[model samples]
Each structure stands twice: as C-alpha cells, then as structure tokens.
Target: MIVETTRPATTRRAARLRGALLWAAVAPGCAWAAVRLGGLDRGPLVQLLAFTPYAAAGSLLPLLLALALRRRGPAVVAALASAALVAVVAPRALPSGQPPAAGPTVRLLTANLLAGAGDAGALVDLVRRHRVDVLAVQEFTPAAEVELQRLGLDGLLPHRQLSPSIGTVGSGLYARFPISAGGVRHNRGGWGFDQAHGTVAVPGAPAIRVESAHPSAPYAVDQVGHWRTDLAAQPPATPGGPLGILAGDFNATLDHGPLRALLDTGYVDAADQVGAGLVGTWGPYDGDWIPPVTIDHVLVDRRIAVRSVAVHRVPGSDHRAVLAELRLPAG
Candidate 1:
C-alpha cells in the first residue's frame, strides 16, 4: 500500500512567505552590486539609481516585493536602513580636515580637456576670467598645450610638469607658485592611473601638498577591481604640517567604493562643503539627449575651509571645469 504524506498547510504558507521576503530583501542589493561592478553608465535612470543605490535596494526592492506579498513593514525598514547607511557613509567618504578661515583664500581650477577637442581658445578665456591660482588638468594633448600657451596660460602659470606618455593624454599640473618637487606616481600600464604632485606657497602659510590624479575609468570587471586595489595601495598622506589637497578627474562617481575609500580616510569634498549643486561635468555635447555625471572632483583634507565651488562650461572638453576657493588655517 502506498502511504500518503503531506506537509502542514500553515508550515508551507510560512515557508512561502519567508522565501518571498528573502527575495525582496536581496533584490535591491543585487541591483546595487551590479552597479558597483560597473554595469551601468551615466544615464538619467542609472544616475538616479547610482546616486541612491541603497534606496534602490531598500525602498524600491522591498516595495516591488511588497506589491506581490502585501507586506509593508519589511520594505519600510529596509529603506530606512539603506538611507541611514548612505547618510552615514557618504560624508565619511569625503576628505576631512580643519575648517577654512574667514580671511583671504586661494583659488584652484581643474579641467579634463578631451584630447581631440579643438576649443582651446574658449578654455583660455575661462582661465583668464578666473585667474585661478593653481590649474590641474588631465587629457592634456600637445596641440592643446600649445594653444593654451598661445592663450597666455604658459606665462600666467609659469611652473609646470608635463607627463612623458601622450597616451591617455597623461596629466599636467600648472601653478603660479614655485613647485619645489613633483612627478608622476603609481604608473599602472594602459590604465591611466597617473598622478602629479607639487607644492603651493601661500603668503603667511606653509606650503600645501597638492596631487592631481586621473585613475582608470574601470570599464571592465578586472579594470574596476584593479582600480579599487590601486586606490587601496595608495599610501597614507605623508606626516606633515602642510594641508593636503587632491583634485582631478577621478572618472568614478561619489558612490564608487574606490572613492569611498578616499572619503573614509578623512578627505573632505569641497563641493559638498560649499553646498554646490549637482554639477554634472560630462556629456555636454549631447544636451538633453544624454545623461550627465560628476566624475571630476576637488577633495581637500578636513583642516582646510571650503569657501565656494563651481563648474565652468568650456566649448572643447566634455567635462566642465571645477573651480574651488579654499582657505588654509593659519600656522
């Protein structure tokens, strides 16, 4: 005789509920993981989700699950947790140091001149109008450099360092102040993980250590993982009294883990401190058709005070220029 066996109806119902809730809890996390793994670009939908991956994981994912399961508490709790995590983690990702002074300040301007762009004249005009104290630029092609020099930037920013490799346009740092010493650091092959460091002199203040970096964009899995490892391999800021400021086209957004490591190390974001709006710096040529993203950044140590931050539009480059005014603490 065949024996009939059946599980309890209540137990089966409970198991089904638990499984549904588990999927709901993990769906958004999966999406967030995908984005972190470099699966999305700087489009509107992706940008919005990118800005708040935790929300996607917590709120959106749970809501989607709730629609099918008729449960709201789990989703609400998950969203709150995600939001809290973002709030807690974001500020920590920025560089932190002493606050800025209420007195005189130094102005810095940075841009990534797309190698093929031909509008050096417009860039020169922007530079002249701003009279920036230090100029940190990436994607500096030879022709672009010549045009910039012709526009009088060479005269204005006499002290300069140009990288040897033209591929990825390398990187460049120009300053009105004397550069005691500077050179490229962490030369990763074909990755464009280049950096330029120099010293800036401010009246009545000690020399400040500045570094301009352009890390690889991390288009593939290995690239993204390698970039993160590269960032991790970065040595801690040298022990010195001078404040540290690192600015450049990072090629990654604020949400990425590599950037998060910088912030966690006590770097304060100049734009965030000065309440600068969402200054998307890429895809200017596409107009409303293409989405915008703020991959370029100016991050300072906590000891510095941020006065203002703005993005200046230029004709030739895809990225808008980032200008920031910061005050160093008196010695």
Candidate 2:
C-alpha cells in the first residue's frame, strides 16, 4: 500500500517536472517572436535581430519537444510563435508574381570589393560572362578601379560614375549603356560613405537612375543609430519620378526595421521576388567562421520585373556578388 502511494506521488512529480521543462523550452522563442513582431529592436537588439532566420528555424525544436511532452499550453504558445516567424521568413524562399512587363531586359550586378582587396579579374569575368548592363560597386578603391580597367572593365562598361577612395566609404557605378548626370552623394546622417549615382539611358526603356548604396554597418552598439540614419537617408522610389535601382552592400537584412521602412517606399528586393532571398551574401569569408547572411541586395522600383537573381563568390572578398536580371517598363 505504501509502495502504491509513493509511485503515484513520484508520477505526479515527474509530470510536474516535464511541464516545467516544456515551458523553459518554449519561452525564449516566444519572447523572440514577440520582440520581432513588435519591432522592438533597438540598441544591441539591432545586432541580435540579424539572427531572426536562425531563431525562426530554432523555434521548431521547442515546438516538437512540447508536442512530444504533451504539454498543451506550451505547445500552443510554441505553435503560434513558430507560425508567426515562419510566415515572415518562408515567403522569401517562394517566388512572388511579377507585374506584366514588356520592355528591354537589363542585367545588373552589385559587389562590395572588401576595400578593393576583392579579385578584380573575377569581378570583370562575372560582368563579361553574365553580360551585365549595370555594375554597382561598394568599398571601391582607386587601386581597385585601375586594376579592373586593366582587366577590361572599362571596355565592358564604358560609362562610369566613380568615387574610389582608400577605404570602405567609396562607391561607384559602371554601365554598358550611356550614363549622364552622374555624381556621388556623401551621407549626411551616417558615417558619410560616398554613394555613386547616375542616370542610365537604356535604348528601349525610360532613363533609370541607379545608386550604389553603402549604409553604415551596425557593428558596435553605439553605431546602431548611425546605421538607422544611413538607411533612412536612402532615396525613395517615386512612381512619378525616374525609375530607380539601388544596389550594393546595405549592411542590413530584410528583417531590419530601417531597411523594411525603405522597402515600404515602393521598392522591391530582386532576390526575394525570385525566391533567392535566403541566400547569404556576406559572412565569414574573411576567416571569421560565421554563417553567411544576406545583406547585399538589388532593390528596384516595384514597376520593374525581376526575372531572376544569383549570388556569386568573389575571391578575396567577404561579400558575395549579387546579380539580378531586371526588365524595365517602356518609356
């Protein structure tokens, strides 16, 4: 009789312990979901938020654990949180519909040259093989420009608006088509990176303005504010104005608030449109051993049709090059 009584009590304790364990499993994911959905990222949270994709993937484990433990409350919470995160992230993997577009197709490539240390031969080879029409380069340096020209970059892309400096602040735009009214804009609110801009005149389409975007990276806690300011200062896509494309290392991901806010202004991520958004363009290439994340992007006017997007590995650079084939509307 005593054995039976003790067995029942032990079972009760075991059940309680399992329930507690389940709650512990599900709580962190739930909190992350709350913060992400609520857009509560600020200060250090900005940097932490870059790992949302990982968080979303991880939320599944706790969900499965809760279901296995048969903890109803924790399971339900986990399910909801997991669903919310997957809903936001999964769309990037699926192709979105494109608008009806009948115009000339243009191939664009964007790359961060890692302060001009990236392989110039590899870059020019990509341009040549891909038949790229526009090339946006970030972290462009004067030495890099000369080396690229030596490798036949100028022959491939005759028109240019370059602002090549000694460090990561420089940017440039090179085009196969004629480019006019080209210049560089220095960031007023951020770390003052130069953004090279130009108006490209494609033969059969309306003149489109292109900018090589290089926002301040949020590496440090204090630099988060500068990062936000840099993103906010990016030019918006105006329907009535010239069609636009912003490409390069934005130092931000789609999950970031400031980047999302910029996207809200009538711009579309080319990779996301063709379901290639999840591909990482930056990370551990410099021997950091970190997992890659998507930061470099080609954001086009919503009216433009994105046919396909590809990411390529550039030797000696931490960033992968992003190539996008886009169709612009007729003038």
Candidate 3:
C-alpha cells in the first residue's frame, strides 16, 4: 500500500494558531484602511481615521507575526495595508514644496483662552519671548480681555480686534501693525463662534487678511453637522487675491473631511507645510493618556512660506497654543 505523507498534529495546530493570530491582527488594520481610503462619513466609524497614524504604525505588529510564522499570504496583505495607510498620511509630515520666499519674517501666536480661565501672564510671556507680530485668541471671555488689557497686551500689541463672548465662541486679534476693525460676525445661526477678522497692514508689505476662528466642537453626534457648517462658514482663500491668514481653535483635525476641504481653498496649514502637522496641539496639561491631536492651526495664504512651527501649553485650556514663523513677500 502507498503511504501518504502527512503533517504532524502539533504542526497543524501551530499553523492554525498562527493563522488565527494573523487574521485577528489584520481585521482591525483592514477596517482602518477602509476608512482612510474611502472616507465614508458614517460618524463613529469615520472618526477612527483620525488616528490613522497610530493604526499605521501599530499594523506592523501583524506583519512581524506573519514573518515569524512563515505565513506569506497574510504577511503580504498586512504589508500592503500598512504601506497604504502610511502613504496616505505621510504627506502631512513632509515639508512644503514651495521654496522660501523673500520677505520679512512674521512671528504669529494663537491660543484658546478657556473662557477666561487661561493664564494671561503665561500667554503674554510667550508673546514676549517669541516677539510675535500678531496674536489670535479664541474662547476669549470678558475676564480674559480685561486681564489682557490689565497685563499690558494693548500697549505691546498696540492694535486690537476683540470679539469677547461668554463661552467658547469669543476671539480676538492683537497686532503690532495697524489693524482695521473686521467686524465680529456669527452668521451661521449663532451656532458658529464669533470670528473676528481684521486687515493687518504691514509696513512695506501686502496687507494680510487675518481672522480668528473658533468653530463649534464636533464631539457629540448631534453637534457634528453644526460643526461642519461652522467650518464651512469660513470663506476660502481668495485665489489670486490678498494673502489671508487664519488662526485659532478650528476644533477639527486634518483627518476630518471638512477641514481638508477648507484647505482646498488655496491655503496651507503652517504646521503641515513645515513637517509638524502630525505633532498635535491639544492634550491634557499633566500629560494624560488623552493622546494629543492637532486641532489648532494657522492657515496662511499659499504664497507665504512656512519657516517653522511649534506648540506650547495653554494653561486652563485643553487646547495648546500654536506658534508659527512665516515668510511673507515684501512689497
């Protein structure tokens, strides 16, 4: 009789275990890949794309397992999934392609004041340290405004465009250069925050259109639609027109479709242009596991070259402050 060659029982069991582990790991990775690629705006599932970076990095674990088990098929699938995720998100980490322009460097600072709870002294110190030419504040309460004036921000900045509110909607723009009143408007059913825009006239340079944006947070299921509309309320950069500078608590990340759409308006986030987009600007002050993410941004006209960008803690506010140094074309 002819004997048939058969694998040992332990080898078969081991192969089954390995295969099980591979699928267990690959399943979650594949789900993330789907959201990242398709961008199906199905609320909760869509939110998972926000952490695609972490998912991309963590997906490699399965690939490693596949290698150890000599599972070629699963290894290939895992490798492709992980590569696609990284490829999609990798652009955010790359520096902008635009060459540095020949212009005066403008130091800008933006922060969320936590409805009068943020530390005015600390903010002032940061401004002084950076020699900021422009400052945009969000969630500026009456108390925060009073504190700023009390703390001599008016003297240092000289010009102001304040839109104070009781809660998260307030904002302000303080600048060393001359700034004309750019009315505080909340045109989106009072759901959008009071965004204060002003024309900043820089000496020997183009007058930059500056705005302070504090759109409603999209944390809850009900608020999600309002949040999208609020972000859309902000006008896109006027093509072939004056360079507009927008900075504040957008409450939306690059992963969010609405925010990405906003960028399609011919503006670029300073942090993204300088390879710091992945570096988050929101987190617990005491360094909790809250997993910091970027929601605050300085969207500038594409003409301006982003030199460098950094984030600092905003006391009393869950959101951090963004500091960006931009090179504007000289007049």
Candidate 4:
C-alpha cells in the first residue's frame, strides 16, 4: 500500500513539473507574438523588431517541444503563437501574382557606402554590369564623390543630384536619363540626413520621382522617436498623381510599424513582390557579429511591376547594394 501511494504521488509531481516547464518554454514566444501582432514595438522594442525573422524561426522549437511532450494545453497555445508568426513572415518567401503592367524597363540600384568608404570601383562595376538606369547613393562623402567620378561613374550616369558631406548624412541620385526638379532635402523633424530627389525621364515611360532614403536608425532607446519621425517624413506614393520610387537604406524592416505605415500609403517593396524579400541586406557585412536582416529596400509605386530584385556585397560598406528591375506604367 505505501509503495503504491508513493508511486502515484511521484507521478503527480512529475506531471506538474512538466506542465511548468512547458509553460516556461512557450510563454516567451507567445509574448513576442503579441508584441509583433499588436504592433507594440516602441522604444527598445523598435530595435528588437528588426530580428523578427529569427524570432519567427525560433517559435517553432517550442512548438516541437510541446508536441513531443504531449501537453495538449501548452501545445494549443504554442500552435497559435507559431501560426500567427509564420502567417506574417512566411508569405514573404512566396511571390505575389504579377499585376499587368506593360512599360519601359528601368534598372535601378541603391547602395550605402559607409560614409563614402565603400569600393567605388565595385559600385561603378555594378552600375555598368547591371545596366542600371538610375543609382541612389546614401552616406555619400565629398571624397567618395570625387573617387566615384574619377572611376568613370559620371560617364555611365551623367545626370546627377549629389549632396556629399563629410559624414554619413549625405545622399545622392544619379541617372542615365535627364533628371529634372533635382534637389536635396533634409528631414528637418528628425535627424538632418540628406535625401536627394528628382524626376527621371526614362524614354518611353512616364516620369517617375525617385528619392534616396536614409532614415535615422533606431539603435538606442532615446533615438527611437527620431527614427519614427524620419520614417514618417518620407513622402507617400501618389497613386493618383505620378509614379514614385523610394530607394536606399531605410534602417527599418517590413515588420516595423513605421515602414508598414509608409507602405500602406501605396508603395510596394520590389523584393517582396518577387519573393526575394527574405534576403538579408544588412548586418554581418560589417563584422557586427549578428545575423543579417533586410533593411535596404526599393519601394516602388503599387502601379509598377517588379521583374526581379537582387542584393550584392560591397567592400568597406556595412550594407549590401539592392538592385531592382522595375517596369514603370506606360505614359
């Protein structure tokens, strides 16, 4: 009798311990899902949201553990959390059906040169090999501008609107076609990063306004507000007015609220349209000891059709260049 009674009690204790362990394993994922689904990423969570891809991948481990343990309650919760995250993240790998848009093809490339330290020759080579019609450059410096012009970038892309500074605040836009209304503007409400803008006349298609975007990064708790402001300051795509494109290092991912809000204003991510959205464009390239994430983007108006998108490594820069082949809406 005593032995049997002790056996039952031990089994009960083991069951309780397993229940507690399962909850512990599942809770973090559930919390993360809540934050992401609710779009509650503010302050430090701004930085945290950049790694949502990793978190989405991690949510699976808890799910497997719950299934193996045969804990129905925890398993249900884990499944819900996993489902929510996967629903948001997994579709990025699948291409959306292409809309019917027939127009002249324009090849565009955008790069952040790490305060003008990136290899000018490699950048020029990418422009040449890709037959890039337009180039958006960020973190441009005076010395780097001289280096690029010396490397024959001017010959390849003669029309230019450049704002080269001594630090990472500068931006520029270069085009093979003539660019009118070309100018540079600073984000006055946020960090004063230069954004170069112009209307490119691409032969048979309608003129499209292109801007090199460089929003302030939310690297710290205090800077989150500035980051939000900078992203919000980006001009919205005019579906009714004219064709528009915003390209360069946005410093925020699609998971970010500010960026999503911007996209909701009628822009489509070129890579996302073609199932190349999961490719990482930042981190690891600069020896940061962190996993790569997609932050650099080419956001075109919803009317434009994205043909293909690619990312390339540039030596001496922390960011990889994004090349997008776009079909503009015919005039």
Q: Each candidate: how many clashes?
A: 18, 0, 0, 0
Model 1: residues >4 Å from true position, as ranges? 1-26, 29-71, 74-78, 85-103, 116-118, 233-235, 238-240, 284-290
Using lDDT as the measure, name the better of candidate 2 and candidate 3.
2
Tell me the tens digit of each residue's lDDT in model 1 across 57-86: 354555456556655665555555455545
Instruction: Report each candidate's C-alpha RMSD, comma-separated, in the order given.
Output: 6.5, 1.4, 2.7, 1.3
TM-score of 1: 0.75
Model 4, residue pairs in steric clash = none
| Model 4, residue 22: C-alpha shift (Å) | 1.2
Off by over 4 Å in 2: 1-7, 286-289
Error in Å for residue 23 of model 2: 1.2
Candidate 1 Cα lDDT to native:
0.66
Cα distance off (Å), candidate 2, residue 91: 0.5
Report every candidate's CA lDDT: 0.66, 0.92, 0.83, 0.92
Report the C-alpha displacement of residue 8, candidate 1, in angstroms.
Answer: 23
Better of 1 and 2 by TM-score: 2
lDDT of 4: 0.92
Error (Å) of candidate 3 at residue 305 is 0.9
Q: How well does each candidate superpose onto the true structure, as a TM-score?
A: 0.75, 0.96, 0.92, 0.97
